[model samples]
Target: EIEAVAASNRVEVKPIVMCRVTQVYETGACVYVYYGVNFFGVDDPLQLFFSIEQACVEVMLRHGAALSHHHGIGKHRKKWLPHVISTPSLRMIQGIKHAIDPTNVFATNNIIDT
Candidate 1:
């Protein structure tokens, strides 16, 4: 999927390292896939990253992969959070935040809204 996206966008996928593993803990089953790509002669770094991430996300969703593997939800990826986290779960998170940081002193645009 990464290769396909790179080809379609005329970008390069130079993965310096690739790793895949699955483990089951008391919490749940987890799948980890990590890779690093080298973008060659990139003119627009922002657009390139967004395009590649979007493509990878779509492919992952199609293949039943979680929206995020290690990275937590942030501003840029908040749009996709709804696809992964349920409404009740989000509300619960917000509630927990409020309980701990009632003033929202540590809140940022990237963190989930209350």
Candidate 2:
């Protein structure tokens, strides 16, 4: 999938897949796959890099992977949140966020938006 994305985006690079050599914790069946895009030179290449990376993320999400593996859902990935999580779950999360950060100082953008 990564290769296909790269090809379609005209990114001349190979996909790099890395796995942990040791177990850090017992996550059971959950495994997080991280995709990093590094490109040098011009602005167009950088933009293409981001586009391809987002495509990779879409593929992962379609395959039942989380929108994010480390950090919680931020503004950039919020569009896909509704598809991944239920409406009730999102409302509950927003309630918790409001209870904890009522002042909206956490800066999650539209992450808590219903």
Model 2 scores worst on lDDT over the 10 consecutive residues at 21-30
Query: How high is each candidate's TM-score?
Result: 0.68, 0.68
Q: Write the per-residue lDDT of candidate 2 for residues 35-78, one digit (tens) a residue.
A: 55444433476666667667767886788767765577677667
Report, for every candidate in turn, its global Cα lDDT versus the true structure. 0.67, 0.67
Q: How big is the positional error of residue 30 in model 1, measured in Å on the Cα after superposition?
A: 2.5
Q: List the lowest-lDDT window of 10 residues for candidate 1.
A: 12-21
Off by over 4 Å in 1: 12-17, 25-28, 69-71
lDDT per residue, candidate 1, 1-114, as tens digits? 666655555666554436565776786656665655567766676676787778777776777667655676567777777677788998898788778888777745444454
Looking at candidate 2, what is the lDDT of residue 26?
64
What C-alpha lDDT does candidate 2 achieve relative to the native structure? 0.67
Reference-based TM-score, model 2: 0.68
